[model samples]
Target chain A: MSENLPFLVIAAPLFGALVASLVGWARPRYCYAIAMVSLAAGLTAAIALLVKVSGTVSGYEYRLGGWPPPIGIQHWVDPLSALILVVITAVAFLAVMSARANLQLELPGKERFVYPLMLLMVTGLSGMTLTGDAFNLYVLLEITSLSSYALVAIGRGRAAASCLNYIIMGTIGASFYLLGVGYLYLKTGSLNMIDLRQIMIAGDMHGSQTVITGFILITVGFWIKMGLYPLHGWLPNAYSFAPHAASNLMAPLMTKVSVYVSLRMMLSVFTPDFLAVHALWAQTALLVATIAIIAGSLIAYSQTDVKKLLCYLVVAEVGYMAGGMWLMNRAGITGTIYHIAADAFMTCCLFLGASGLIASTGSRHIRSFRGATRRMPWTFAAFLVGGLSMIGVPPTCGFFSKWFLIQGAIEGGAWHFVAALIFSSLINALIFFRIIELAYFKDVEHEDDVSHPPQVQRNEAPWGIRIPLFITSVVIVLLGVFSPRVINWIERFVDSVGVT
Target chain B: MSDVLTFIISRFNYWIYIVLMMIGLYAMIAKRNYVKKFIGMSIFQTAIILFYVSTGVKSGATIPILEHGHDIGHAAAAINPDHYANPLPHVLMLTAIVVGVATLGVALAVVQKVHDQYETIEEPEILFKLGQE
Candidate 1:
């Protein structure tokens, strides 16, 4: 059963999508049910895999079709991958649970395709996390990209245009990644990451031009996908134009998973020794990340659309993880790994809350949020919690991760990044607090109006939506207080990859 | 000058890949029309495919299919690995081709939708109309 766990996490969703598509026309509601069940099972598999792999120095590998690595594909289940599996599956399950109502309303008659596309996307992301082969990662990435494209295209108005921009950028990113993989295969004669790493080190190709070119191309490609700083042009429009359900799923996972891929590549494929050999890449990466942190926040602050604001915040958060990891210390890498999980939950909470607000209040701009606190208490509370976390408020998971990152930066003597981290936290505070003022204080100012508006009444989102928001909001604080434990596990995971 | 000429002649295939890829990249970046952009994407994908197929080329090597009646894993009578071309790139490109097709099909659909909604496939014009809204 343990041997089959990796395949189960992926195959269940792929096959679930197939089944959902077949039974979809007859009963579209069944598609949602099927997706939820499959994601639940996948969550179980991921948890079991985590329990099995945690603290184990030697990770498990399940070769495809009984063929060994170097000749066939392999599914590697280290502590890191297992943890990511749990994050992806658990959040996906909740996203699906909350999707039914949104589909019933905004996406009437689209559940036939939406639910199945969501399942296929989950399959792609989890496959990407679990695969040990480099080329296999490309294939999985494309699967995720293609499914996400279809999902994004289903909405009316500008969703199609935004999706075209996304497809154009996404294809270039994937092609660049493929070209990098081709270079690696040429230099090492192997496509499996473990095999390539061994061959690279044994042949002392670490300093070779081919290896350097591969690293640069691959990092650029991933940076594009993660939408860091300058390459972030396509993200906000693409994400904001998506249907609420699709945005809920894609906004949180897509960039975060791409960050995980880059982290995995930096640690496993082009080991830390490469960083030491080339201080240039680390310095350049941190510089780019610092710029991203500042620019993302400033742009987010200027956005009037609530969803667009969240999209820019996602870009800033991507910088946090990327900058944290490149500090070339254990503290920074641990912080990055922890933030991947934390940010996933926090982002989900924020997106779901936005979806609920938009659906009920029938407004997409920040001005519509006036008196929102009175209208939807539960949803506003969740958004507030998520907002505080985004601002790095204590006792939320974001604070701890930022703490680790700052400590790592100080140790590395990268004072610029430390300053950028603090500055961005301040900006995030200003942005969220401004929104709070819009929601909370705006009504009291209008109290003196000669024509007083009718009091905003309670109209909370349906239970299907409310439950997931509450769960993820509670999860942010829970993960925060327990982050020390999370860090310890991540340290061991990093150690198993020999990154200490 | 003779060495430069010889070098270019020997490595011209790579130079071609680079040239085609640059052209595609330029089109992808600079083109205003959506179809041209997608065409650029296809060209970029094709260049990569061409690059991958080039990796499999071995001078004087036969196609990877085995001749009839070859011994099956006998220690003394094994087929030479070099006698056949590297098939891995070709196999991998088959998958890439499929991915390219999927992306192109989806992209065309998106372009169609965008054209229907905005009445133009040129990005600048759509932005102009959107600004009015």
Candidate 2:
């Protein structure tokens, strides 16, 4: 039963999707309940698997149909994957918890199909995290991308064009990944990650041109998926134009899950020793990552729309994680893994709160946040907490991850990354403070307010919106205080995978 | 000269795939029309499919189906590794092809919507309309 947890986590959502399609149109009310219950179950199973993996000596691996590697699809739940799986499930659950209210408002007639699309997306992400087969990963990635494309298009307005752009870039990304996977299969005659790793280790194929080409192709594919800088053109428009419910989920999990895939490629598919032989790529990647941080921040600073600003910040966050991964040390890997969860919860909390505010305020521009603290106090509080976390304040999850990321840069002697991280944090400070000023200061009744305080009404968003925002904000802070323990587990996993 | 010609001719599919891929990429990036871009996307995906299928061929091999009842072990015949073309790439390409079709369906649907809203699928005109907003 314990060994089956991985399959169960994915199966729950897949079943939910089936049920959703069957009953969603006729009994649309039940669709939300179904999605919530299924995602909750997936979250529980993921937590259980994480606990089981932590308690055991070795991580759990379930071989489908009792066949061995390269033939059977294997569910590999190492601590690293378990961590990411848990984050994805938890974020999916939180997004579902907050989706009901926003979905009704943002996508009025589309409620029937939303549940199944969201469920399918969750299942695809869970499958991507669990699968040990490279080809299986690609299949799951398409499942995720295809569902998201439909989900994005479900809304009115510019959503169709946004979804189309996402589909185009996403398909090309998936195609490149398939080509790379094909090349790897041709070189090694195995599609399973572990078997391919063993073959490379045995045959020392690291020096082979085919292997190198596969590496380059796969990295480019994932970078596109990761939305790292130049390849991030589709993200801002696509995510911001989608329904807030969709944006709330897509904003956090999409790139972070792709980062996990990239990590797997770097650590499991190609050993760290072999990566050193290709240091030039890592170095170039880090340089570009630094540029991404600065450029993303500068561009985000210029955005009038709150959602678009947050989208650009996500690109910068990707730069941070990618830079940490390229540092290629234990501290960096630990930071990168820890940041994956940290960033997800923080981003989810912020987006959930922002959507709530948008619903209440009836505007998308930053100017709409004027007096946000007055009308939506709890939602504003969630924003504030999540904002502080984004700014890397102490006792928030973001700070610890940034701390280790900076530590990694210092250790690796990469002053450029350190400078970029600090500069981006400063830019983050400016971005958040600007919102704060607008939300708090601009709404005050002029010079008379100093003498007489004006009453500000609290027309808070519903509990559905408030509860998830509260939970995610609490998660951000809790994960911060417990960062040491989290980092320990991640470090152990990193070492076990020979990342150091 | 004959050897060089043979070498080039043997891998003609790969060269064609490269050419098609380049054309598709250029269209996807530079074309102003959404329909043309979708065509480019289709061509891009097909080129990759072609590339994958071409990788599966062996010079003198038959299809990968097993010739049963003529067991090499029982007949004591020499078995060459390349006697059958690799089937894995073909199998994977089937999945890719399905994905391609699904993507195309969604792309066309979105294009329809785009056309309905703007009355044109040209990106520049769309951008002009968007700027008005």
Candidate 3:
């Protein structure tokens, strides 16, 4: 059981998806229960893996079918990947738990298709996180992307159009990644990441133009996939137009997983030494990330829709994670790994809260939030916690991650990044305050008109919605409160890899 | 001039892959019609498959299967790697082909939905309709 824990993390969801799709056609009611049980099982396996791995500095490896490395497939779970696995499963489980009411409201009678695709997407994400082969990662990335495209298209208005755009961009991004892996395979003759690294080191291929080209291709591919600034054209629309249930899951996990892939390539496959040799490239990447932070925030400030605003902020958060990783020091990478989990929960929290509010009020506009505290105070409170976390307020996970990122930027002498982080945080505060003011204060114009009386009846989302939002908020606080231990765990992985 | 020609001829497959990929990318980015965009997507994926499959080719190498598989214990030491073409890349591309087909199917289905919604598959016209609504 211990040895199969890593595989079980993925298989649970895969099995659930299969069962949901098969059993759903005849009995649609069972799909939700099946999805919940499967995802819960996966979450359990992931937590067990994390607990087991917590005791050791060196993480565990599980080979498929008892075949050894460099030949058969491998699932490598170090402290970092294990932590991310837990984050993925936990966020998915919460999102799905909340998804019942949201999906029924948004995509009625489609639970059968939606549940299976959601499970498959989670399976792909877990596989991408756990797999040790470069090519295997690409296949799993497609599985995740393909299911998400289908899920996004399940929405009503203009959904297929946005999904089409997402498909084109996603294909290009994935193809570029495939081409890069091809280049690496040609140069090193090995697809297994550990084997490829050993071969490159033994052959001293760091200086080879082919290897450099492969590195550039892979980095740019991940950049497109992760929506880093200039290449983020397909993100805001695809996410905002997606069905609320799908967006609740995809909005948090997709880009963050892509960022993790980039970090994995840099840390293990390409090695930090290769990056050090190309300091100019690293600086260029940092500069781009800084611009992304400022641009995402400034654009987010102009949004009228609450969901779209959160989508744009996600763009900025991607910049935070990407920029933190490029800082290349111990603190920077630890912050990045920590932020991935932190940002996942906070984003999930915000999206779930937004969707619940949207459902309760029957509107997606910012004005719908007027006197929201009186209308649905519990959901509003969850959104406020998420908003505060986004603003880097203390005792939430967001603040600790930002602190580490700032320390890393200062140590790395990248003042631009530090400035961008501060600037983005201020913008986040302004945006959230604007919403809060609308929610807390009475609409003055409406008070003057006295025609409508500003209906502020107490209407909250179902317990299905409230419970997940509540748990996610608590997790954010818990992550922040126990960040020292989390960072300490991340540091052990960083130290083992000799990244600094 | 002869040396340059030799260089071009030696890596002709890579050059073709790059050219095909660029053509596909341009269509996917610049074309207005949904069908054309998917056509380009298919071409783009084919180019990648070509790249991977081409990497597996070796001169004077035969298919990887052995005639006496049942007697592999006696023949295991006698196998020469250079005598057999690499099968891994080909196997990987089989998976890639399946993924490509799946992506193409999904893209076309979405395009069908777009057509049904707007009565047009031209991107610009669809956008115009969306704007008016």
Summed backbone clashes in each candidate are 0, 0, 0
What is the descending TM-score order?
A: 3, 1, 2
- Candidate with the greatest lDDT versus the true structure: 3
Winning model by TM-score = 3
Cα deviation of A335, candidate 3, in Å: 0.9
DockQ values, each candidate: 0.90, 0.74, 0.91
Off by over 4 Å in 2: A444-449, B1-7, B67-81
lDDT, ranked from best to worst: 3, 1, 2
Report the lDDT tens digits of candidate 2 across residue range A1-500: 87788889999999999998888769888899899889988999999999999887658788877888778889898988998999999999999888899987778767678889999999999999999999999999999998999888887788887777788799889878988887788789899999999999999899998898898899999999989999999999999999998989999999999999999998999989988887798889899999999999899999999899999999999999988999998888889999999999988988998898888877898888877777777789898899999899999999999999999999998899999999999999998999898887766345246565567677787788889999999999999998889988898788897766
TM-score of chain A of each: 0.98, 0.98, 0.98
Output the worst ten-in-a-row residue range by lDDT, candidate 1 chain A. Answer: A441-450
DockQ (0 to 1) for model 2: 0.74
lDDT of 2: 0.89
Q: Write the per-residue lDDT of candidate 2 for residues B37-96, one digit (tens) a residue.
A: 988998999999999889889889998776664665566355565888888788888988
Candidate 2 TM-score, true structure as reference = 0.97
Q: Sorted on DockQ, highest at the top, how do the candidates line up? A: 3, 1, 2
